[model samples]
Target: MSKIVYFFCFFFCFGIAQAQDDLLKELDSDSIAKSQITAAAFKGLQICTMQSTKLASKGEWYFLVAHRFGDLTEGFDNFFGFDNALTKIGGLYGVTNWLTVGLSRHTLNKNYELTAKYKLANQEEQGFPVTIVGYNTMDINTKLSTDEFPELKGTDRMAFSTQLLISRKITTGFSMEIVPIYIHKNLYEPLSEEVDNFLLAGGGRYKISKRISINAEYALRLNANDSSFYHNPATIGLDIETGGHIFQLVFSNSQAMNDVSYFTNANGISDGKGIYFGFNLYRVF
Candidate 1:
């Protein structure tokens, strides 16, 4: 099974690398002509566990693979959570220069997500100080069992989130972003009757070299219930660009990657004991 997976990854990445070169050349030509606009604030489409202001260019496609292993505190007994890894695979396409859409499936909770992101504005070198983007996602929980609920409805399995991303390139080697988010859950957890939640997430990145950067992010759940057992999500990551693709190594306190769960359902503790190690890989064509 591992061999099969490796073969599939190599097949697509190798094949796409050649075609991507042509597309990138054309893209570079266009981008270089825009002298007033600021350059990209983030290298990858994501800054650690949160979405970055970066968007796929028109007609571009991106393939993403993300993994979150089990609790690292479990020690060598669980092989540092490698034995209980959760995988997510997805693809995104740019409908236009400013609009992008994506779909993904996750192993945790058998969740499926449909996402849309659109650029609202861009930072200008001497004008606007920030770039703005809008992001929304709808989640479907397929693992819900009628046997457990005895009254499960299609609506009960649905969840949604919307966010406004604001980012700025502070300097040549530094960037930061803030996101105001809204989340709704059709079926609330048994512990709380609230169906709506609000959060504020923030993150930043600093370039260390030509090919490496350090990134970190954290989300604060504003309306969390006092009785709830979940903790806020926090993550630190290292981004490595290898010419053809980007690789991200992550240390996070959350295992849920879906936007809805990532903001509202993180269960890990903030302390080092509950950390979960993960990685995200992205390929473009």
Candidate 2:
């Protein structure tokens, strides 16, 4: 289970690996030890910046432990709330300066999903400030009731998604990313009515300071009466960097953290009063 809190943060760490060689050359000339520089580079996750520009001998890897609790329906008197819990492990690797690859897995509410992300433009000075393109896919492997699958033999269709992240450096230690997304489902059905099988979304992340950042994202359905996707989805969270690990604590209307669910499935109904809970834990190694 590699996909944890926010897949993007883990991917950001890989940017440093791509420039390790030149960085080593320049810094070594200035009397810096490779080990020391590397250690410092790893620790510098506290800041949103790159450490190097090449795939050095050594790269980075990390895992995550996550817990999420929420309910789309909430009531103390009636208390007919639906809860969701998740646990996952995720990581990223550097391929070149401003480019990295990432993988993650999330298990929550009986659904298992996988994700991958690739940074297309992080250190660019062209059409966009910082742009990243990525994708995710999830299979509904949860057990089924006898009536749903009396003798289940075939595989269920998967949910697929893609995102284009555009961000900018606001200042010294602050940056933000605007994410535009698309989602597709092989089969979508609703109990009461038919729902759309696709979704469109937008979201962003902001650095609050050197070690903390804020994130707020939202999605709107293109299909007018799509019950398969959320009517509207939004998320707000904070990012904390700790040495070799980066942790993100988030609050989202949608319990799905990875792209397939979080970016696309969040309808955020119940008058935006759907859930009142938190999503915890994340990191980069």
Candidate 3:
């Protein structure tokens, strides 16, 4: 009887140990799988006026509204430039964890844009120190009139921009991004120097609180011609987060909303003029 009891106890102890070992192995595997990906390097799809490394999750949708008031220096006559606002309304949908597609329309040039973004690499946990994304945008100038150019073709109203976004979250409170951009215009303004434009843009954000951040961005046109009236665009802003929305208030030297217009058609920046107020609101679903 005693030998039988001892054998039974040994088997029961062995089974319990085996089950614990299995549970531990399963937990380890779960940890490994969950640790392979990092999340939320940025809270919004845009850092300010430029695209950020952030993307919507699969099946999620985002709506963006951007408004740029006319130069604030216009004073009370223009109600602090509120009377001459240019607005952009857009929507983006995530097709997958790493891909998003969007469309937007800007009042500045009566421009419509189709945009796509792909995450090439993610920062940390994926053996990468920085996140990389590819962005492509195609814009159509619907406001172009045959009266301005009797020989204008449909293709002449098309413009395209390609950008590589590289970003790093240096710390829990600070993040930065560098963008290398190429823009192509099917047709330039009369006597304009270049149809192809090269630009380098940099942007950064610092978290001031759990729900607020300070942001800044600048785009420098590398191949700007002497006759080009555009100047380097720079902006400073604050981002406020509330529930499922983010609100951005900014001051910038550029009035146009689209990349081509803001980067190439910007005027009155040379002598400290053309500083405008702008805001962006994002709603996520």
Candidate 4:
């Protein structure tokens, strides 16, 4: 009888211990699963002038406004280039958690653009160490005149851009990204013989506070047909987040906002001589 009671007690304790161990293992698995879904590698939809690997939550709406003044060295006679500023107004909508669509109009070249972004992979999720996203944009030049070239068709005014955005969050406060971009223009400038352009863009962000960050970006053309007329675009900026809005203040050597125009048509270098002051405001709803 004594042996039977001892055996029963031992079995009961063993069962209890086994159950507790199983419960702990389940909880640990849940913790790791949650950790795999990373958040906020970048604060806003853009790192500076290029798109980031962030997409809006489902059903969210975003309003965007951007401006670029003329060359800051234009002197006080032009009010520091504020008198010749160009503006871009646009809106973005989240179709899903991983997809966004946008449309915008820019004063430069009277350009109209439609854009789409899709998230492909996320960092620290399912053994992935980096995030990847795909971007596509179509631009139309409304300012082109048929009188200049009677043979020009409507399609001649169209341009397209495609980019692959890859990024990593190295630390809690620092992040970086690389973009491989291809731009196609139906109408090339008279000086250039190529209709296609390839560029490599890089950007980085460092958080100074919860609400502010220092940002910079540069786009380098891989194949330049004319070096004198086209230069790589570089921008440095500050990102300020307040409530549901993001405000960006920057200095850049490019005047056009769209990829095709800025990447191919930029006439300024990163040097101070042709840099222009610019700002972007984003509001979320």
Model 2: CA > 4 A from native: 1-58, 72-84, 89-105, 125-128, 138-140, 145-147, 150-155, 190-200, 224-229, 267-272
For model 4 the TM-score comes to 0.86
The model with the greater TM-score, 1 or 4, is 1
Per-candidate TM-score against the hidden true structure: 0.86, 0.63, 0.85, 0.86
Whole-model lDDT, model 1? 0.85
Model 4 lDDT per residue over 1-285, tens place: 355335534643553355445446646787545556666689988887788898988999999999999988878967887889999999999999879999999999899999999876667744557777778999999999978888989999999988878888888899999887778889987575357777778999999998999999998777667634678888899999999999999888888888778777776754556778898999999
Best-performing candidate as measured by lDDT:
1
- Candidate 3: stretches off by over 4 Å: 1-35, 190-193
Total colliding residue pairs, candidate 4: 0
lDDT per residue as tens, model 1, 1-285: 355335534643543353345336636787535537799899999999789999999999999999999999999988999989999999999999889999999998899999999876677786556777888999999999999989999999999988878899999999999987778899888584248777779999999999999999999877778888888889999999998698999998888889888887777775557788999999999
Instruction: In candidate 1, list every pair of residues with a backbone clash.
Output: none
Find the candidate with the highest TM-score and give its number.
Answer: 1
Model 3 per-residue lDDT tens digits across residues 1-285: 355335434643553355445446646777535545555567768887888889888999999999999988878989988899999999999999889999999997799999999876666654446777778899999999999889999999999988878888888999999887778899886455468777779999999999999999898887777776677878889999999999999888888878777767767566666888889999999
Ranking by lDDT: 1, 4, 3, 2
- Model 4 RMSD vs true structure: 15.9
Q: Each prediction's Cα lDDT score?
A: 0.85, 0.46, 0.81, 0.82
Give me the overall lDDT of model 4.
0.82
Query: lDDT (0-100) at residue 256 of candidate 2?
Result: 59
Q: State the weakest 10-residue window (summed lDDT) of model 2.
A: 45-54
